[model samples]
Target chain A: MKEPGLEQPGIAVEVAVPVRRTPLDEISRVKMLACQAALGAVIALAWQAVSGRLVDDYFISNPLAIGRRLVAWIGDGTIFVHLWATLYATIVGFVIGSLAGVVLGVWLGVSRFAARLTNPYLLALNALPKVALAPLFVLWFGIGIESKIALAAVLVTFLVFLNTFAGVREVDRDLIDCARLMKASRAQVLSKIVIPSAASWVFAGLKTAVPYALIGVVLGEMIAANRGLGYLVQFSGAQFDTAGVFAVLAVIAVVAMLLNWLVEIWQERMERWRIVSR
Target chain B: MIELKNVSKRFRKGDEVVEAVGGIELGIRRREIVAVIGPSGCGKSTLLNMIAGLYPPSGGRVIYNGKVIDDVNTSVAYMTQKDNLLPWRTVRDNVALPLEIAGLRRAEREERADRVLEHVGLTGFEKRYSSELSGGMRKRACLARMLLQGAESLLLDEPFAALDAQLKLVMHGLLLRLASEASQTVVLVTHDLMEAVTLADRVVVCTHRPAMIALEQAIDLPRPRDVINVRFTNRFRELYDMIWDCLRLEYHEELI
Candidate 1:
């Protein structure tokens, strides 16, 4: 026979423990930033010390020389013109390509027949090295920003498209059925359920596509262009100006990081409900 | 308001056809709380899915309000075994989802969601995401969402099967109070016999695979009953034992 209790039968009395709520804090942001800055300083100091002694300055330009080149370019406003050109192509191409990819991917994702029909063609296109099409894009769109934009758009499209397709396909079936039971229209299901559910994946695709967009634009500019960072790189390489090449490369790295950071911020804002702090 | 006429479901897994639920005939009256109790994997959930019209029955028809359910039945709210709450939405937003789908105004939706969240004792946790909630709290949120629908019927598939024993007791009290107050038709599918006896007006026991009705026993316990002390009563134990005896027979048959 089990002893009767207020809440449960034959259960031992549970000790009451008061829970203390405390705010969770990870490694301070300022500390992390300081560490990153220190690491960068250490690398730069090592390079500056070894330059012209252990290795020729022509091979790997000294950080001081690269900094001087960047300062000179900034003083003459040479950096801003080329920076703006590259930024414009990368941003515009990325937005257009991502939007188009989302539409196509979502459409194909929802339609099994359409996805199956275009599977082989999409796979073949994706498998093809997009960098190889740089010359062709320049020939078609010409040496202006159009060629760079077109090349970037093409590269971003395939990457975003594949991710969006997978994301849409990966949406939880149970969530869809739950919505359907709540009298959700097909459009409602897609907008409210499918799209939001696949948002993380879309963000992932966008994040990866950012660098690829820059790569595509730079490649196109390298193949044929009169302005932009790629042209600067090629011109400096031809002149054997290692410091100029390094400065331009450094700027490109910063731009890529800035674009990636923007995507991350957008993802965090949009997916506020997904708390990764477990 | 729900009727299943010879309901059957068979799933084709690769080349083999597995019959989940055999022909089942069951009619549930309006405002009745019916609990279908059976062994695990006895096709109990398949029956509820038919009522909710997730998928059409392989053999028979499921009738809701005198009309056969062919498409997804939006009239009845269903809470599957999984909470199925959208991970990207807060407790308030998740509770307001059905209303949002129905094109309800934001003010009206939030007001109703607030009220329902309070009713489910999730008053201050409205902004918390599903990932942050404990299992019991998530279940309550799901229940609040279901209640906010204001549907005439609710089909719950093992709704509280995942909760701890102490939490389960509390949830039972909460559910009994709500169900009695609202008087909505509820079809609860659970393998827990005690739970079936506690909240259900009638308990329907099902057999093994290709589940058929083995026993349908009415719980004659008085209303306004305390879920905690009710289990200690002689009548509750008798009902539990009776259902267990029938369920034990099914298990023995499965072994043989």
Candidate 2:
């Protein structure tokens, strides 16, 4: 609302504001989303057209058949059992691995002697392919969620550790010096400066570790498991059900994308200062 | 009051020994503003760091209030040229850091920080992050934090060298007023000869390397001097010329 008496004395005032122009970045973002959706639609249409005409449904599964199978599984509530199993293992392992990695990474990063001492052993463990160790994990933990959890933890740990180490190593020397001059205690320095400085690197490691967590669980399930998404794919493939395999793969893709979206939201919230400062 | 008795700092390279300052004796009286000026890389900064207790002197002792400092001296607040404000923190939070270290309650510290920010002409910028602020604004925030520390002394290393002429004058005026009001001692390391003459009660000129004091001249200018106006006077010009004369001798030595 405008004050009637505050207007220009002689001329009539256009109190109502004129239209505002949309920002360039916002316009470009909308155009990019539209292009992505259109591209996805084109791919689906081409797949549908080639389903029966060029390739048999028994061999390369049709998109429509896979969609119908997805609907059927959702309606019957059968996919939930396997999905919950894989999700439970992945989430549990991810939490444990991330906690251990961040804690150990910071501790070792701060302690020069300790990092030098454990250099060879940490390198050797990371040198071995995590997937190849799934069999050994299965042998040790039996054909249960324990094996999957172990595998996932092993995969996630190294990633978070390396990023955390790098973050700690490159901490701003000037800030640390300032904190010390302020008479900050050792614990104060750790809690106030070190952890907050390393938070971005830690979150980046967590985001990258998401797919590796899923891969670990799937690998363990494939090696030996009674129920999981990996087992679903294996069971359907053995029965020569290409449609079932494709449907399970599609479910995994959607699940991965959804989890990644959630993490991206979290990263945005954690780094809100960047938006304003920039 | 602070006293440096034959203080010197030396660093060892792989095989060579680099002497920064060599056996320089100085005393800073209570509530005095002393500026150390010289050519580039003359160990002026190293001398200030020792005074701040960021580094130990290789020879002799640095005594503050009649006590030798062995570690970080909380009685002094050191401000370098970089400003060194935390990028992730807002201006208010950055200024509140020293109070936080001192364990003041949140409400109490925030109120103090607010008053200091207002005094520094940054009243409405409490929500702005350090990265969002420009160079001069960030320097103001740093000054606010140093004020919050409320230490007995201030060790400033070219804190306004990066600023423009007009801004530097404004900063010099604010610093002089604040330091004199609080009766706090200040040791400044500056590359600008005019800045030394404008602000210091006494100016110490150091030689190029192994920085012994080349000359210690007192600026007998009137109190409460205007930074720009005082520069046009003869007293300020004479002090600047004297300091520059000592530095010019070193240039001739280097040429030889």
Candidate 3:
């Protein structure tokens, strides 16, 4: 009775009506891009004008000050070190967590008895704020990159696990039956049918987990680490350097966007069949 | 040969027990194409499911090739209303799935899949995903996959019901040609009277719910009959009207 939220894993015939583009369409697309750029510029100009005049520089950093701070960090290469540290933890944690989640999800998905038995415990863990586990992770792994990775991994595991579990459960019974009728062995059915069927669902989880991995790494760094973007933000805030904090935040935003783009590329590469070009 | 001896099936929906099929006796000989026609929700599909060993009959037995089918009937290639072709795999890979399951090498699987795909008129579409193909093409791909299984028996549960009239006729011709060449026994379940008359050697009509045999008529059409033009023929019309008459009675009983 559980309908798949994702598209069905079999032949999904979708009509891709090609839209004819006229000069007006091109003009409109250019206009839209221009408007977006104008909006961003307006916001930046307004912020720059308001700082020190409308609000104290200490309270709200000016756009120019934040830009200068970013340039200074880049020139000294200190930004790269913090950036690499955060990136390392995020990537390592994402891989480990995603693997664990997929393994656990598939295991529970295949066996109803195990899913039912561990349902309460799993629910309890998911409900608890994973950030609260940062202190414990720090104690166990020491206030190093391992702690950041552990926190990031913990946050991502729950997210990917839930999506993967639902994906596996939602696989069409008819598809499985089709394989069985073909005399497919149990291992073949799992490998060839079940896993591929749940792939889109797993990718959906991975996409969302990108930002969450950053969040976990940042929070871990803020709580205890001497390195990473989170520590930079924390250190700048303590020193009352509002521009430095803003500069570090901007870098984090860029990193998050970069990670998300990478995941999107990975999904598109693997599931090119789902894409309709337009 | 597939035989159903007083086969019956019941499904429990929460607290209510729904008898899907009841005391149906049918025999399908080797290389024979039999079509089971009935009103919608009359458990025509349940009969095929039982024969495929997807569901054990609530009563009686389903015998296939001198053995009672207790588990999934690996000897039969089953195709349902939905194509059920894997979306991720290209048409060739989907058709070659059974051979891959049988542990054939990649080279052999692809070569055999190409031959079968060509047989189903889908040679040029081997590398395309199912989603990229049209409905009729996807059905052809599905049929190709089923044919590649090399099973002696084919259980088709309204496989061409979703296609247009023209497509249906084309599919009918393709199925007839392929089934006859392979000498595969086909049990086609459908409510389409014309399709039943056009393809089946024998048409078994079942009544409303708790499906039981109402009429069993044989089509004595000659070998290598044209599926499309045969519909316009006098004998085809006679057979169609005869089967429709039996189906009309089932519909009338339901209204009453």
Candidate 4:
């Protein structure tokens, strides 16, 4: 019996070489962060210096006054109720729409006849502006969370649907043939190959839909709702309270940042297995 | 045994009707290694695809074990030049794919996948995704996946085209060794003349578009060939010159 050498060429040389010897990349990252902080500080100071000087503070509220209003909102604890209401609508809509979209996308993606028959109609429906339909949704579902959820779900469903359809279509034919040769059934192929292949596309669409979902919620609230960030903004604007408007805007900004941060973490975890580093 | 009975294939794109393979009649006995050499886009893969039942021949049928194949042939396993491992799956999971299809339990499939990975010298790479591995490692993982299927017939399309010289020789040795264990019938399509002579029992040179069997040459070299040194032998050189003569002659006519 002959013994195998297993002597791989050049791979050993590659392993011997260090990945990144210098700290230049790390230093550059720190420099970028410091630059952003400095920019924010300058803007804040400039706003404070000019408060009630060139323009009346009533028209353009100062950062400090907005902060004070935010502190006051926190003290009364009513802010939590509004925040929860908005959050509840967004979550319910996102879940229902994303689930329905992926399921239908996969079904239509697999069937050429079904995809062809309904593609144009789906596109036409997606093309319709959500704002134009907001009033109808309110009238149909009433001025409650149901209307808000409907608005958000409609906005989210299409993005996920299109992405998933393309993803399923983009799956390599050779891979499917390879599996078929292995004697995999149709159900097995769909479950094990097609669905897993479409996952990244679904995730991408979900990420893009986040801002739009929030938009749908805020739009519904501004049109007829009793609570939410959008309603708060509309109420303050009506009363000519600029500081109150900025405070509500700040809360919305914070919530958006938190959602985006969570998505960033999720995206990192989902795509960590990617081999694009080389 | 697998036999192609005057098989032919044609593809249509708008007004363009292209004939890929024309009257290809061939036979591959069980456990025989038949190397097919052809020019680029010469329907070598098309012929293999027909035999695998992925593409229906326009004219004739393919016979496997004296039975005509009209649908996908599960008795065969195929490997193409491109590695098609699922990007989302780890190496172990990819290797265990066929087992999953066979409805093997998780622990059993994992155990089987690990053993095969060990055979392919990919033990530490079980957890790594296909995107993380080097080209050679990815190829090995693909081979491991094929190995787990336990299919008796294989249709290989330029399977080792991406490998370096030394690695190709090692893989060729491993392939021959593993092939003989299960009496696997391998129909390999490669551009390398030396590879054909060294690894295959018989070599078939295919003509340019509308491919037909231009020349069929048998390699009478003894078993267990040393892939690195076989090209030095007079018989190997003679076989190489003969096949190259046919290829060069056909290519010369294509210049017109």
Candidate 5:
């Protein structure tokens, strides 16, 4: 209750400043957070409504009931065991695949003879549907984590290999000439100049390959695994436990987001100079 | 300290064999600065390259310090028109590169690199990358690297052509000062007539295409040359006129 000419000392000014938000930054941040919360709430509400309206509990359980079930699973240590199994397979497969891919890619890119000789073989292998070969992998290595890991590694390798090969090939010729003029020895030129020049491309490839690495692990598990999140999804779906299947999917989405976030952080650290200069 | 005896270079383009330089004989004495001036495509760079041991002549031998030159000679430093600085290395590291490649200890190479950097007025730029530098600064960095090589002779292939007029003059002065102090023999190839007159004790003019020595004029002008003082001098104009007269004929022939 203040006159128009004489405003309240604290309340009016405080409200006015916030309403103005002239910097645009604070306003944008607030708006973004609001949007995120709104979207999350809408999704949750929609899921709750759909589950509530379902005629059969076996087909679609309530979102609240699924949340409770997930909590119970976590408490009983089943979630931890499943997550560990997936993580172990993924890490081992990713490391082996990425290392082999980079080595082969670099060698092929540097030597024309090697590239020419191996191009047809590589293309044939890359073109073949890897998922269709899961049965063969299971047959060859037996139906253990080993077969799944091997399958995952094979799936991840081609993506990394192609990216790295293109990256190495795309290194600037001018930089190479400069190194030659400096009288740099073959090893020095390769390690010091060529590798660093191709670094940005290699990192770009790695970023694109991160999601593929996770997908590879999941695909391998789905084909045949007794303990992974993918196995849980398959088992739940067969039993018509729709809530349990959704819970497994939700865990996978979270893991994927976390892995992608870690990749972005690594990329930022590697390309700090490029970002700062830009 | 360089002797090119009847050096000729030819390039085969499709079915045509074009001679770039024809039987050019030149002797560059120890600590002498020689500038080769000619019209475009007159094979001035080809001659310099032969002297630097970067290219082999179709006929004739290039002798430096009484040794027949074959591949890139360790006793010679050649600076191309392009700066050619490695973007990855800091300025100090780039300057010390030749020494490192020659198997010198890191400590000794760093000391030599520091001395050359100071000599080239780049004392505070040791840690700066080549990508962060301006055109003139990059040229200076290249010059510093050449200085660090401790070569007996320097071959400059239009090293200052990329610079503006003002920067070019400043660089010309810097080169003159450096050449005097180092007492290193230098053979420079350029199309700029005035640059040749200003920096060189002797200038060699060549004819166009299948180039041959048209004239060799000795500049008797006094040392520690002031560009301002020399620019107005009658001797400078006379030398420029002499080189231009020879180059004009070659230019007309090239047009035909």
Candidate 6:
């Protein structure tokens, strides 16, 4: 019955105290917010000065006018259709590419024969410029969402595959020997030893691939698309509405940032037991 | 009970074949602690690996309890020189790995793991990761995991060789006590002569590369031994001199 962290011999109940933030921490946060707001204001004023009016007849529009246009577009369900088209393409491509990469990467890492046979092919594919294949994808899959998804999947697969394969292959050999001596079955060794050991690497691959998925979707739309944010940019540029183009670019930037933030949250949540912090 | 009869191991390097262990014959009785000592590249570790079923002998059989061990088995636990705890797992979960892999229920595994943790002086550190622990604590965790596996025999490959003198003595005491309680048959490989003398019931001295057993000596020290007391005894010096005689001759021959 020793008291915790004391020289007594009695049972003690410990209470966790919430951490108190200092004035310096509060000031730092406020400064960050102020800087962001200032930057946004400067951009808005610059757009107003360049456009010459709140609403233009044919040329570039003002920031306020573009905001109103966005509101109207959202109300008419146009934004929803375009957003859904891009999002659907990204999700489908990410799932298929990531799954294939993880499976093949692990297979290659564990088997010498597989690694030897596929090494040259993997290197040759990785060396090729992924963007150059967009036209081929369109020709093979048409101007539909399938072509866009296929392009995105190809871009993301290599990044994830290399990270996961290296992660598994670089595992501590001593741990493998220990598991083997304990009579672990091949399946158990893979699930319990190999997968958990390579989790950080897999997560690293996923983080890198998330950005690739967004880039793939945008690139696909840039080549040939009737909807999505990239299409919105094209439409605005064609009309000489620079403000509208900037606004659409801003939306894509925000979407990409939001996706990255979501990935960070997921990684942290899944790796609570891991040694390295996300 | 373990026996190695006419065992030989060879490895191919480039175009040449090099013998690692050559024509070795040895037997260890049940619950006996035997220490194998030799110079570097003497293939002591290779012999222990063959006994632990990590490798197969090229010429002869490794019989454990009258059964030839050719592949990995759960009956023996091998402690490597490097601590191999999973970084993701806490001390408790790491210790319970064998039980979990053997399909024991969670509660039962936890209970068994906790008991072993207490034995290793890690009762309050169940949630600590391997990264958070010091070197000695990590080594203790490795020992606790081996104990939780509940193997009848242990093959340790210079487990305490990396520790400083003080920590090595403490760990040696803990290991000897645990082995006594578990009634385990232990085969230890080490280059340290003092370590071989302290914990072993019998010592096997091996020659240089393409190694073979040179001499075997029995130690009849009392239990719950104190190193200070043992060192002061004449029997300690006698065993030390006997081991040195063989080691000195082997060392000179290799140089020549």
Best by lDDT: 3
Stronger candidate by lDDT (2 vs 5): 2
Q: Which docking band does candidate 3 fall into?
A: acceptable
Write model 1 residue lDDT over B35-139, tens digit each, in one string: 998889899988988888889999988999999999999889998888999988898999999999999999999999999888778999998898998888898
Against the true structure, what is each candidate's TM-score?
0.87, 0.87, 0.87, 0.87, 0.78, 0.81
Q: lDDT scores for all predictions?
A: 0.90, 0.88, 0.91, 0.87, 0.80, 0.84
Q: For model 2, how does the per-residue alpha-carbon lDDT over B1-256 read when each residue is reduced to its tens digit?
A: 7999999999999899999999999999999999998877879888888877888999999999999988888789999878888877889999999999889999999999999998878999998888888888898899889988988899998888767788788889989988888889999998788899999999998888889998999999999888889999987777788788887897667568
**Residue A12 error, candidate 3, Å:** 53
**lDDT by residue for model 5 over B1-256, one digit each (tens)?**
6888998999999999999999989998999989998887778878877776666899998998988988766567878777777665788888888888778999999999998788667889888877777777788889888877767788888888767788777777777887788888988889888889898999998998888999999988889998657888998888888778887887888789
Please state the Cα-based DockQ of model 1 relative to the true two-chain complex.
0.53
Question: For every candidate, what is the interface RMSD in angstroms?
Answer: 1.3, 1.2, 1.6, 1.8, 3.4, 2.2
Compute the lDDT for candidate 5. 0.80
**Clash pairs (backbone) in predicted model 4:** none
RMSD of each: 9.2, 9.1, 9.7, 9.4, 8.0, 10.2
In order, the candidates keep a fraction of the true contacts of 0.87, 0.64, 0.71, 0.71, 0.13, 0.58
Off by over 4 Å in 4: A1-27, A275-278, B13-16, B220-248, B251-256
Tell me, by DockQ, which candidate is best. 1
Winner on lDDT (2 vs 6): 2
Worst 10 residues of 6 chain B by lDDT: B223-232
What CAPRI grade goes to candidate 4?
acceptable
Better candidate by DockQ, 1 or 2: 1
Supply every candidate's count of residue pairs whose N, Cα or C atoms clash at under 3 angstroms: 0, 0, 0, 0, 0, 0
Give every collision pair in model 6.
none
- Give the Cα error of residue A204 in candidate 6, in Å: 2.1
Indicate whether candidate 1 or candidate 2 has the larger lDDT: 1
Q: Residue-wise lDDT of candidate 6 within B87-133, one digit each (tens)?
A: 88888999999898888999999999999888767899999888888
Instruction: Give per-residue CA lDDT, model 4, range A2-90, as digits (tens).
Output: 12354456433222334666665557877989988999999988988787997788888899999888888889987787888888898
Clashing residue pairs in candidate 3 are: none
Write model 2 residue lDDT over A29-70, tens digit each, in one string.
779899889999999889888878898867888888888888
